[model samples]
Target: MEIKESTLDRVKRLKEKYALIGQDIDSYLDGLIYANPLTYWDYIEVDSLLSLQKPKTDFPDEKIFIVYHQITELYFSLISHELEQICKNGKNISDAGQDLGWKDNLDVNFFIERLKRVNKYFEALTRSFDIMRFGMEKEQFTKFRMSLLSASGFQTASYRYIEIASTDLKNLVHESKREELWNADYHEQLDNIYWRRGAVVADTGEKTLTLRDFENKYLADFHRFADEYQPINIWKKYQELSAEDQKNPLLIQRLRELDINVNVNWPLVHYRTAVHYMGGAAGDEKGTGGTNWKKYLPPRFQRRIFYPELWSETEIEEWGKSWVEEVLAESLKTEEKLKDEL
Candidate 1:
């Protein structure tokens, strides 16, 4: 068959492209002739993805729990991806423990766009958490959870990476110790990241097995990632922008939204959901032998603000305070109804 003029023109351009790399265009064309057409199923690995839910127990709801967490981590990975892109163009920390070179190809619009994407992911996760909250029978959840041993959603590394990539290391220190640890050494700062507060033994101060395992696996990587992004984290990059760009209303709005999304809304959803599933014991149900989710998951308790300078004093003080009260009131009502039924 005669080749169409359009096809000949395309092939001519393709030959030039391969000639630049000194490759035989005809050889590549021959391979394409023998290649199978791609299918959506093979590309997405649908069968392998569906087979991932190997629930440890026969409890049907356990599969829901497993799949939901997998989806959440996937979202966390997306959030981290955007953050890494934002920081990629900025100067990295050096062996001297400070970013030395001045290099930034960052666009303010790019910053806002990526932060908006991160906010959307968090918003979607918050909305979908109801799936986990109401998806399982409380009887089944409570029973199946025991089979999980020290495993807990609190061990999510991508979520921790989100926090580390969002701001300076000092901001993640527990509020009560922020001032004391703000000037502390790097290892000390890592040791005091606020999440550790939730993983301590209640009576004797010791890390829970879940927290220990997490630290063993992730603590080194966390330090390296934090150091690499120290000079270019979202908050630090925001600080380094020109005063005019810093004052951009939309930019500020996106940053503040990110702060609230990660620090307040995300934790609050887990708090309320824990109340629904674990009931009053949710307060006591922190990762095994730890301070409990109530202590860790409540924004009012941690008061961990990322962009503190962006918020007014009153806004910072009242942050997550009202939401805590509302959730507690709802929890009380839930407990009363359970008592009445019993």
Candidate 2:
């Protein structure tokens, strides 16, 4: 009898809680009557995910190409999530009239952990470029790639967001253009971002269809994100730390790891893949996305270092050069082998 009374009491509590939210207990119970039990496929939306890889070509390898990019975009989204959480944790530092030394309120360990998570996601993505580098049949990929004109991974907005959220917007501008925009507003500087330099015609120096389409779709959203994150960006939050905390070895190590993982390591692997597929017998092929990728994709050329304040002058000067040369050498050998096979 005591157990029966306890069960009735629990139901009564649930009914009272539902009433507080303008829900009727009897109506909720009636709705539950028709609900189906969850299955793994339904819970995870496996069918919906599998349905996304719509290939433009009938080539069997095209699906692998499509799924690989989709997976990379998902990883970009994961990094973005961690960045957003970091911003949330530090938002209180931006409150009106708050003390400038607001790092005391922020949790340094929490920020480091979140950054480590972002690095792990990047590590997964950097390692996964092998799938793009070798997973598809070279001949089939070359054929199917022609079908994707002006649709390059260069237009990935989430990847852009990852960079914007990771550091100050100034750090993302090209080294040549940084001086010109040094005193400019964020909106003006946005026009001169480093990645925009990647999507221009080599001869005419005009925007490609890929860049124009990206701007049309995401320019406004990117600006909004920039404004929202400007005050709470990781670099700015790090600056808020006391000088001693700023020099913490663990924090500095994570920052440098993040810089290399996102900028150097990922771009070198990607550039190597581009060199392998596009660097054929005719020398540099015009990228299907319509950019001079040989000049644009390599980290040495792009020089997209996020934490420049952490590195020495020589390190910055030689950024992405050593590994890039190694990758290019390997790509040449691979290209020669492919030619021999054909």
Q: Which stretches of candidate 2 lie over 4 Å from their true place?
A: 1-34, 90-105, 322-342
What range of 10 consecutive residues in model 2 has the weakest lDDT sum? 93-102
Write one digit per residue (lDDT tens) for candidate 2, span 228-325. 98888889878987898897666776787788888898988998998888888886678855577888888888788888898778778989866534
Per-candidate local distance difference test: 0.81, 0.82
Please name the candidate that would achieve the greatest lDDT relative to the true structure. 2
Q: Model 2 — TM-score against the truth?
A: 0.83
Cα lDDT of model 1 by residue, 86-205, tens digit: 887533554444445634577788887888899889989988999987888999988898888888887899888898889887889978789999888756787788887777776666
State in Å the error of residue 298, model 1. Answer: 0.9
Looking at model 1, which ten-residue stretch has the lowest summed lDDT?
323-332
